[model samples]
Structure formats: C-alpha cells, structure tokens
Target chain A: MSEKIVITGGTGFVGTHLILELLEQSDAELFCLVRAKNTSAEQRLHQQLAEVIQGSDYAPELINQVKKRCHAIEADLQGDITSLATFIPSGVSQFWHCAASLNYEERFAAEIYDINVEGTRKALALARALNVDCLNYVSTAYVAGRNTGVILESPMAEVQSSNVYESSKVEAEQLIYAQQDMKYRIFRPSIVIGHSRTYHAINFSGMYGFLRRLIQFKGMMARVQRGYLERESIRMNVDPDVPINLVPVDKVAKQAVAIARSDSSNTIFHLTNRTVPTVGEALEVLFSTVGLPPPKIVQDTTQYAWIDEKFNEK
Target chain B: MPNEIFVIGTGRCGSTLISNILNHHPDVLSLSEFFTFVTDLGTLIPQAFPAIQINGAQFWQIVSGIYAKQNIMLAHDIAMKEVLYPFKTDVRFNASTGVPAILQTTLPHLTPKYDALFDQIHTVITARGMATAEAHYHALFGWLAAHFGKSIWVERSGGSLRVIERLYQHFPNAKFLHIVRDGRDCALSMQRHNGFKMVLLVFQITEILGIDPYESDDRSWQDDLPDELISFLPESFSGKDFLAYDVPPSLYGHYWSGEIMAGLDVLDRIPAAQQLTLQYESIPNRHPQYH
Candidate 1:
C-alpha cells in the first residue's frame, strides 16, 4: 500500500515542486489543502501544478499522474481549519505545512502575522486533530536574523529579528517546538528562486524585485536618452563582497522530501546552496543580461551626488 | 527606601504599559518617565547618577527644569503621545507655558489631581537639606510611596535601558526588570514616536557635528548636517514636516540593537538574583491584565 500525504500550500512555488518530487520519489496519494479564489480548490492546484511541471523540462505524463493521484481539499489555512480534519482521509503519514505570508513590509504586518503565526497555530491544531504520523514544517533560514557567525542546523537560540516576517517565522518555529508530544521534522530553506534548470518562477519577488526594477529603469532611461545606461553608472549602497544564500525551489523540495521519507525524528535540515554568490557577482549577470553598465557598489553615502541618489532609489 | 525596581527597556517596547500595570498594583507606586524627564539626552548617565550631593533647591531645579528636547517638542507642538499631562485642562502649564519635568509624565500618571500632587511634592522636596542625588531620590520615591500607601516603588521610563549602568550605580539595592520586545517592532514603534525621532535626529547631529545639539551652543555643523536630517533638528523641526518625513525604520532598528547590546553589559555587572528579564511577547501569558 502507498503512503497517504496531506500538504498545505500546494498552489505555491515550493509546494508545486514538492508535489513533483513526492510523485517521482514514491507512490504517495497526495491530499492538498488549497484556498479557492474564483475556481475550485482542485482546479487551482491543477493549474499551478501544470504550470510548474510544464515550465520544467519534465515529461508530459507527470501532469496526468498528478491529476490521478493528487486531490485538493478546499480550505483556508488562515481561517478555521478544525473542520478540515474530517474532510481529509485517514491513514495520512505526512503533514507538510508550506503556506506562509511572504510580505515583509511594515504596512502589511498584521496580515503577515495572521497568515504566518496564527495560521500556523490553526495548521498545528488541524494536524493534531488528524493524528498524522509526523508534521513536516517549511520554515525560512533567515529565522536566525542579524546573528553574525556560523548558524547550526538545530534549534535556534533567542534571536533578535529585524522584520515582522522573520520574527513571525521565529514565533512559528517556537510554536512547533512547544508541541513536544507530537512528532515533527523542520526544513529551513534559504532564499528560494526559480528551478535551477528552467529558471521558471511563479512568484516574482525578493531577488526578482531588484531585477524587475533594474530592467524597468533601463527601459525608462532609454526613452529619455539613447544609450544612456551604457554611458552612465548607477551607485548602489550595497556591499558587493557580501555573500547571499539563494537556493533553487526544486533543490529545496527534493531535499525536504528526501529527509521527510527518511526515519529522521525531530530534526532540522537547512536547505541552502553550498556555493553562495556575492552581490557583485549576481549584479554582473543582471547587468550583462540587461545590456547595462555594472553599478558602482558604494558602501559609503557621504559623497553621493544627487544623480547617484536618484539612480540608487530605482 | 522600601523595595525599588526600575522597569527599563528600549523606548516603545511596552514599558509604558508595564508602568501602568505597576501603577494599578496595591503595593507598587509606579514612577512613569521619572528618569527620562529629569536627565538630559546628551548627559543621561552623569545627570541621572549625579555623584555629588545637592541641596533641595538644586534637586527641585533638576526636577522642574525644562528638558531641551521636551521644550522643543512643546514649542513645535509635536509633544510625544506619552506625555499624558493634561495641558488642556491644567491652567498652570500648557504646550506654550512649560510643564515641569516631574509633572509631564510621573505625577500625571499617578493621579488626576496631579496639580495638587505637584504642590505637595514641591513642599516635601524643597524643605530637605543637602544630600546625595541618590539619597534625594530615595527620600522622594520613599515619600511618594508612603503618601500613596504603597510598600514598593517601580520607576519605569521609556528608553531607560540606555542608562541602566548609571541606574545600577545609584540604586545598587534596587531590582531591575528589563522588559525587551522584538527589535523590529520596537524600531517600528520608535520610528513613529516624535520623541525618538528627535533623539535619532540629535544622534545624527552629534555624529556629523561632533557636538550634541541639546547640550552645546555650537551650531558649527548646522551647514554640515545632511540635507535629509537637517529639517528634523530641534531648531527647524515642525510637527507637519516631522510626520511627513519617512525616516528609515532601519535607523531605529540599529539604535534598538545598540542599546540592547550596551544594556546587556550593564546587566551582567548586577547579580543575577537582582535581575528579571522578560520578553514583551511573553508578558501577556504571565500577566494577562497587560492584554
């Protein structure tokens, strides 16, 4: 008999990849918790899965297999999920909670708390109600906020976080630990991007937000003066030598599922890239791709001119 | 001087709420913003601790002196929301006419008849002979606690953690309740606060000009100050412009972390038994009334 798995955030970037990984790795019947917007939950999950699978160079028959094995139960993790325990089938061995609000701005702080912290509370309650064998949580590696030094793949100490999103994740991780009796496994993935092979991204934020702004600025500047970007340089107040850890979604999903399948008990796995890229290295690729001059990374702003400030604002 | 406890934290970390909670307790006489009002921003440690002995008149002057930041805020009509003194109802002091340092937050937080309380405190504080500043504080807080029929006193001022070392020197026997919140939330709250905005701006002024604007008459760096921060200085600062300017929250975040890091060193000097560290997030579970 195949395993029965229940997962939330099946419509998300990492969730779609996880579904593919689970399907490829084992004969598991997937029950996805999806929030219906205009269409049915099943439709939403299928649509996201189709885009993710098609975007990658995977075989066409994967979608058919997904359609056959994967089932979507209409549920909002932010709302009352206690009733979901009855809807989901029994004998489910794995419960993966991947839904989270990625908004890090201060304005959407309350909503972020609602989705990230309180939503986890509801997810945990539903997981308990369902009596799943293990609760597999997808947390962010940035939970170790502002701590300079080596971070271990274990329980985090008291941390001083900089934003609501990271703080909310820290709180969520604490909530998971507070559930001592329940068996659980935690995955802390760093800055997830598009698949390594296809580079197809559903959510265009974080690193991509910077990319979009650069491209948009280039387009705007070209209309004002031909070959303007090629001539003039922009100043960014970023340390070009600083390392940024960016992991691919497919790799994160693959590692997460592999650990989940193993007999690991109450362990934390950091799904991060071994080789991190410097800000200058990443910017070089971006600049070359957009046909713009490389930005002058200025850590000091005392000598910044008006034009330098304006260009950096973009 | 009965039992003493200073509830300290980086400002906007729910210290105000903690002070209010302590105020409601039958055995605790909560002193709100006492240290903040009495000490100047530039000379917080020296002013607060005061190694030398001072007469009643000098102590009264320290208590009633118009703090430069407070004066600026009042003159600009940008008083912090934490200044709970009912300037509208009280005839003696309004925003234009200066409110005494003690009357600003401490006395008003204690009672509705804060004007009468002020008169009573003035009579007691000024009648005393020369004594150490710490001794004067003891007599004052001890007298206040006795007058209110409380057995213990807890003095909580927003951003008191910055001067925790000086506080330890003055009140060596006092227990310290260090209430901390998430730095991000603290920074967000501090960014919105008029008092902290002025303080951060003053900090920038100090860094750029090599002189504390609140302490020195040297306006040498007025021209040297950055264009973005110059408007926030006390001289040209206005309520409208202050609110309109979106000061980066990260500045406050850095300030919060700096204070916490410095405060931890001071806390380490004190015995572990005298200290009680509480997370602002966890306080609700311990004291539900705080909710």
Candidate 2:
C-alpha cells in the first residue's frame, strides 16, 4: 500500500513547486488544503497550477499526474479548522504545512501574526489530532535575523528579528519545538527565486521586484534625458562585500522533499546556495542585463545624492 | 483695552529685527513666528484657512505638528536663520522625530526655556473644547497676553504678506502693519535664503506641471519633467542639495513684485485706521519717531 500525504498552502509559490516535486518523488496520493468559498477547491488549485506551470515552463506529464493522484479540500486556517480533521483522511503519514504571510511592515503586523504564527498553531493542532507521524514545515532562513557570521542548522537561540515576518516565524518554530506528541521538520530557505533553468517566476517579488523597479527607473531616465543613465550611476544602499544568499525554488523543493523522505525527523535544514554573489557583483549583472550603468554601492546615507534619496523613497 | 497687531512683509525684509526690537517692550507681548506656525510655510492659500470648528486637541495638533516640508528643512539643518529652536540642546524632539511647529521659532525666540513653555501651553490648549480657528487663536493669544502681564500682543512672521488674505479673513477687526522694502534688495536677500529657494522651487514646479506634485498623487507626468528642473523637485532633492543649488536673483525679484501687488490688492480693502505701511530702509533712521 502507498503512503498518503497532506499539504497546506498549495496555492503559494513555494508550495506549488513543492507539490510538483512531491508528485515526481513518490507514489503517495496528495491532498492539498485550499482556501476557497464560492469556487470549488479543485478548480482553484487547478487554476493556480495552470498559471504556475505555464510560468515555470514545466513538462506536460506533471498536470496528468496531479489530476490523477492529487485532491483539493476547501479549508481556511483562520476559521473553524477542527472540521479539517474530518475532511483529511486517516493514514496520512506526512503533513506539510507551508502557508505563511510575507508582509513585514508594521501596518500588516496583525495579519502577519494571524496567518503565520496562529495559522501554524492550527495546522499543528490538526496534525496532532489526526495522529500524523511527522510534520514538515517550510520556513525562511531569515528567522535567524540580526545574527552575523556562519549560521548553524540547529535549534535557534533567542535573537532579535529584523521584521514582523521573521519574528512570527521564530514564534511558530518555537511552537513546533514545544510539541512532544509528534515529530517535526523545519526547512529554512533563503530568498527563493525562480527555477535556475527557466528563470521564470509566478511571483515578481524580492530580487525580481528590485529588478522591476530598476527597469522602471531606467525607462523613466531614458525619457527624461537620452543617455542620462549611461552617464550617471544609480546608488544602492548596501555593503559591497556582503554576500546575498539566494536559492532557486526547484533546488529548495528537491532538497526539502529528499530530506522529508528520509527518517530525518525533528531536524532543521538550510536551503541556500553554497556560494553566493556579493552585492556589487550581483548589481553589476543586473545593470548590464538591463543595459544601464552599474550602481554605486553607498553605505553612508549622508552622502546620498538627491536622485538616490528619491529612489530610496520608492 | 488690549490691542492686537500683525506685522506683515515678503520676508528677508527687516521683520526679524523688528520682532526682536518689539520683544524688549515691557507692555507688549511679542509673538514671533506665530502665524508661520499656524499656516503651512507662510502660505495664504485658501486650503490653509479652513473655517471648520475643531476641538482643543485638533487645534493643538494644527499649531504643534511640524509639516513635511518643514521636517525636511529641520532634518537637513537648512532651516532659516530666524529659526531659533535649540535643536542641539532640546531633549525631547529632533529633526527625525519632529519638533513642534510653535517650538521651531515662536516659543524659543520668546524664552530659552521653551520646553516648559510648551508644556504649559499644551496643558491649557488641549483642555479647551471645540471652537472656530479664529476663536481658538484669539483665545491663546489673549491668554498669553494675560500670563505675561502685557496690555497688547503684536505678532510678526517672515513672508507673512503672502498670507494677508488669511489674516484679513480671520482678524477682521485687528490692526495691520505693512513693512515695505526695495524689490531688488529683497530679491537679493531671498536668493541666498534656503527656505525661500525651496518655496519658489515648489511653486515653479506646480506651475510648470499644472499639478501640485508634492500634494497630488498623480505621477502620469513623471516623464514629462524637464531634466534640468527635475533635480530641484521636493521629491528628488534633499534640503542640503537644494540649499547648494543657486536660484537667480531675477526670479526672486519677479516674485517680490507679484507678492507686493497681490498683498496691496487685499490690504486696500481695509479701513485706513487698521493699516500702517513703512519702508524697510526708513526703519533704522525713523525708529525713534515710530516708537
């Protein structure tokens, strides 16, 4: 008999990639928890998968496999989630909880905690009630915020988080640690981008968002003054020598699934590139790719030019 | 009987010196930069003078809250020379966490112990109930006159002539003091002044863009800006950079002429008893005669 797997956040970027990876990895039947009211959960999940597959340029066989082995169950983590225990079938060997809110601003602090910390508690409770063997969590490497020098893949110490999102994840991870009834695994990936080969992403955020803003500035400058960007350099506030840890989504999904498949329960994994590009090196590539002048990495804010200040505001 | 007076000019004139001189008078409560704190950047635009009634807290916020443009100036240390707020020594507030509007010039110039004065004023003002803007201002000024043992209060603010319409609308019965100066000399003085330069740049951009870029959310014309003029825009330029950029004296001279004409157009409507006009050059020689 094949194993049964349950997953949440099937509509998200990382979750979508993880689902595809799981489908390719094992003969397990996948049940995805989707947030839907008017529309059917299957329809919503299929719509999301179609968009992601198109953007990612995945092979045609993945859709047929998803249709055959995958099922979508309508559920909201914030609502009466006790009913989820009934909907989720028994003998579900693995529970993958990947849902999280990425907003870090103070205005969204409440929502971030609600969707991230509180949502994780509900998922953990459901997993416990269902007597799932192990829980696999998808978290960010940034939960080790404000700590410098080599970070270890062990239990995290009490440290200051730079943003609301990081702090919420820390709390959620702590919540998992207190659970003694079941085993849990945490995957911390750093700045997950598109697949290395396709270089396409359904979500245009993080590094992609920065690139989009740079393109906008380039277009604006070209219209304002021809050859202006070529003559003048845009200033980026960053340490030139500091390495920016970025990992491709496919690599993260593959590593996470592999780790989950093994008997590696109650462990933390760091899903990041072995060698990362420095701020200056990455900026050089981005500027050249957009055919604009290389950025001047400025650490001192007092020395910021008027244009630099304006762009920083945006 | 207590008398209320307002000394108005196109700033960079002799208003600061006049206010300083009046500060010494035993019987007069000199309210330096009072109107400046009330209105946004000495602007007499109708938006600055909403006739709506508000509670004491709202009024306090209006008079105490630092405007965004003013915050930029304070943050960059590009505030006008007349601003005597002890930012370096003040403990509670700074440029980043904004110093109150009244504390910027009005309260500090009156006394070095501005913090205590601020606390006292806050207690009194915030305790009062809802009232018209005019009534609230009069109540505060009247209370100040009584507290200082003075028979009258005279308010003076730089570039106050620009806000003649506001003053005229609010204080219909009060006496007006118009100080005149040579447009060329005023323009020369204003050319080097960072505050004037910033205000002029904002107005110029508003005129050229046909939209108030700072106030409006529309960025459809972001690409329509002239390259040379784009850097001086409020969003694009910091206060320090703006201070370094040189605006022509000719532009200030033209601005002075227009201000004088517009001010005269409003001042002409009031009674002769309420209006008094004096030249900037004659003040030094005729000081004793006026006193």
Candidate 3:
C-alpha cells in the first residue's frame, strides 16, 4: 500500500491546493483533518480543486486522482488531539500540521495561543507518538514579525510581532523548533493569492480582503452615481517602495509539495516571490483590474492620523 | 401549548448566554435571533428586485408568509417563501413608492383565491425533499426543545423590540422581556456588535418620524421610546409605561442584567400562575428563589 500521510487544515486555502499537488507526484494516501462545522469540507475541497484543475489542460486527469486519494477526517485543532489518534492507522509515514487561526482581529489573545501555540505543541506530541518518518509543518514567513529589510530564509531565535496573530505564529514556530527529537520540516509561505491565470481560489486572505473592500467601495460609488450620495475619493497612505510579496496559491502549493518530496536536508524553504511588486504598483494593478480608479495615495503614513484616532475612538 | 417566553434586548446584550442558559433548561428551548421574516426579506428583496429598497409591505409579506408557514422550519421556510415571491403582489409595483404602501394597497385588494394560491406554494415546500422548509423549522425548534427539554420556549433575538408587537400579534400567548441598557454604553457596544449599526440606523429613522431624539451621555433614543416603538406599543400605554433598566458598560453585564429584569417585568405583568423570572448572577450561583 501507499505511504500514509496526514494533513491538518486540509480544508483551508493552502492545504486544499497543496494536497492536490501532493497526490500527483507521490502515491501517498493523503488524509486531512477538517473542523466539524464544515460538514461539506470534502465537497468544498473537491469543488475548488475541480475549478483549478478543469481550467488546466495538463492536469485534467489529476482531478479524479485527488478525489480518490484525499480523505477528510473531522477533528478540531482547538479540541483534544487524542480524539484524532483513532483516525490515523498504526504506521503513518508523514504528518503535516498546517492549521492556524489567521484572523488579525481575534478578540481574545488566549484564543490565539490556544489554537496556534498549544495546537502546534499537541501536533508535535502526536507526531512523536506516531513515530512518523517526516513531519512537515506549514508556517508563515511573517514569523520574522516586524523586522523588515531582507528577511532571511533561516529561522530567527527571537521574534517581535506587531499583532497578536503574528505573535502567536512566532510562538508556535518557536515551540516546533524546540522539539529536539522530532524530524521536522517547516514551509513558510508569504501572502498567498489566486492561481496564476484566473487569480481565483476558494480561500480569501491578504490582498483578497483589500479587494473585497475596494469592490464594496465601488458598489457604494455606483449607488452614488444614481444620486444616493456625492462620490468621495477614498485616500490612503501606501509607501511606494515597500515590497509586497504575494505568491500565487498554485505556485505556493507546487513549491511546498516539491520541498516535502525532495531528499534535501534543508529544513525550511521560504515559499516567497523573489521579485515582489511594490505596495503602490500592487494597489494600482488591483484597482485597475477591478475597473476602479486608483485611490489618491498619501506619501506620509503619519498624515493618516485619523485611522489610528478612529480606532482609538472605539 | 408550551409557554412562549421572549427575551427582547438591544444588540450586544448577553442574549447568547441567556439563550444557552435557557437551552440548558429541560423545559425551555431558547433560540437565537429567529428573525425569520427580516432575514428572509433582507435576502430576497435584494436578490429578486435588486434595485428596489426593502419596505414595510415586503416585510409584512415575508412575515405573513412566515406566519402562514409557521409549522415548517421557522427560519428556512420563511427564507424560501421570500425567494419564491420576492415581490409583495403580482402588480409589479413601483419600487420608488416603497413596500409598506404597496403592501397596504395590494393585500386588501387581492382576492381570497390569490391568497389560496400563495398558500399552495408553502404546502409544496413542506412536502419537498430533505432539508425542506418544514424540516429546517422542525430541526431548529426540535434541537432547542429536545436539548433543553424545558416546558417553555424562550427565544432571544437582537432588535426584537423593533418587531415585538408584530411577534406578539402572531404568538398572542408570547410574553416579551425587553432588556434596556444605558444608551451610550449600548451604542458603544453596538459599534462592536454585528447588528448595532443597523439598529442605530433604525434609531435615525425614528427621529425622522417626529419623535424627540432623547440624547444622553451615551446615544439618544427619541423620547425614551422611538416613534416606531411607540406605534408598536398599545395606544393606552405612554412613554412612561415602558421601564428603563440601567446596566454597567462591561461586556455581557448589560445583557445579563437586561435579560433578568425583562423576565421579572413580564412575570410581574402576567397572572400569578404564568410567569417566572431568573437572574444571570443567580443562575451560576444557583439562587434558590430562581430554581
């Protein structure tokens, strides 16, 4: 039989795509742990994969292969990990822990710690117990936190997070690194976007949120055109030079699966765009793509004092 | 018939907790925001017409449909009915004139034959496959009653007071518990909560209805009772008849206090045999009087 490989967060954006890519090269039996609430995760995963695969002429046959090999096991990372043990058969070869709460504005800090930090710790414990051949954990490149200017692919001994989410991820990464006996591989991908051609994916993250907001603003403007309200040009401070690294979802999945399959001892691979677009250029492309006039860009970030003031007002 | 208890409070008051607690009661099946009519109309009006703004007649049709199909899944049935007939009447009425006026003119003029035709659509929905409108309502109420197993059914929905009179019209035996907090704190809390901004918009509309906008340290309500709310209240009852229960600004504190007080007030109004009031602080503490 094929090697048994288990992945958590398989229903998520990156995991869903990554699992599909993995099914192609390796004859590994892929299992993903999905949260119980999403009863239709398998269906959703299939639908998303079909959208991506159907468009591609080369990978048309991989659609049925993915459906046949990939299986979703219901278990929440925030809940007891021991419950998941029953799903994994005795001789599991590889385990991938990809689940993490990526929401920036999670109300409680403890919730972030519970899911991101404690959850990783539990996954590591489970991996150790199973005696898995390889444990490939997916983390974010932002685990470097607030440190800007040439973030190396190497792991940092210390991190300083600007937000609770970043801090929790940093903590989780640190916990994973501390597990001395575990044979681990960490894949840190940058802000993932739609597949290369259609710029479409099932999950929404990073630029997707900004795009949604822009679309809403445009809709509001359309309403104003009908004499609802006077059209107002939204202004924002975006540094023209700040490099915004956005890797396409398919590229990230492909690179991650390749790294997982390779015999190289490199424990970490930075799945980031080597040549990233500037913040200004990215915004221009995004607005133009959606048929909206580019926003009036403010040079100084300090000029947008109202943004902070409004948040403080709350 | 099981006693129908409603915990009516502004948004962000501990309605979820109250629902969960009531859910624990063997005789009580407390549901969260079963605003079947509003949610259905909200989705349908936007989807079908797309151009026309939602009005009172569209709302009434949605509500009437829900009342017409109450035996089906309370929420899903209403949603489906609205989707089936997005417009109030077959007249294809002017969108600019608004829904309420359209409904008033259209409903009374419609022959009894048309009403029967509409009712037939609901019956068709009830008889359909798995996840049918009836099944959804059954699952919703059944989950609540079976899980809690209490003799009473309590439903806590945000902005319920906005439609309390209408709700009372349908469930005549229903007792309302309106939980009020300090306006300022409620507004601030609302700024964080999901439906608070919409409620504030409703408050703004109430101001347009010629009521005194009662501004406090927090936010203002028109004359302690907004005109819309005043219209809903019995004509015999004045602004003073509705009681204001003050709550602290802390999370869940305002909600719990308002819920307990609303229940107590309802209990006081009902004949000695019919009502029971339970406090939030007392629930966890296990107060003997409440148990």
lDDT of candidate 2 over A46-125, digit per residue (tens): 77887767767578668888888789988888776756888877998899999888766566688889989999999998
Query: TM per model?
Result: 0.52, 0.53, 0.53
RMSD of 3: 19.7
The parts of candidate 2 lying over 4 Å away from their true place are A37-39, A213-231, A288-291, A310-314, B1-291
Off by over 4 Å in 1: A216-230, A307-314, B1-291
For all predictions, the C-alpha RMSD in Å is 23.1, 14.5, 19.7
By summed lDDT, the worst window of 10 consecutive residues in model 2 chain A runs over A219-228
| Quality of candidate 1 docking, DockQ | 0.01
- Considering only chain B, report the TM-score of model 1: 0.92
Residue A248 accuracy (lDDT) in model 1:
89
Q: Judging by TM-score, tell me the better candidate of 1 and 3.
A: 3
Better of 1 and 3 by lDDT: 1
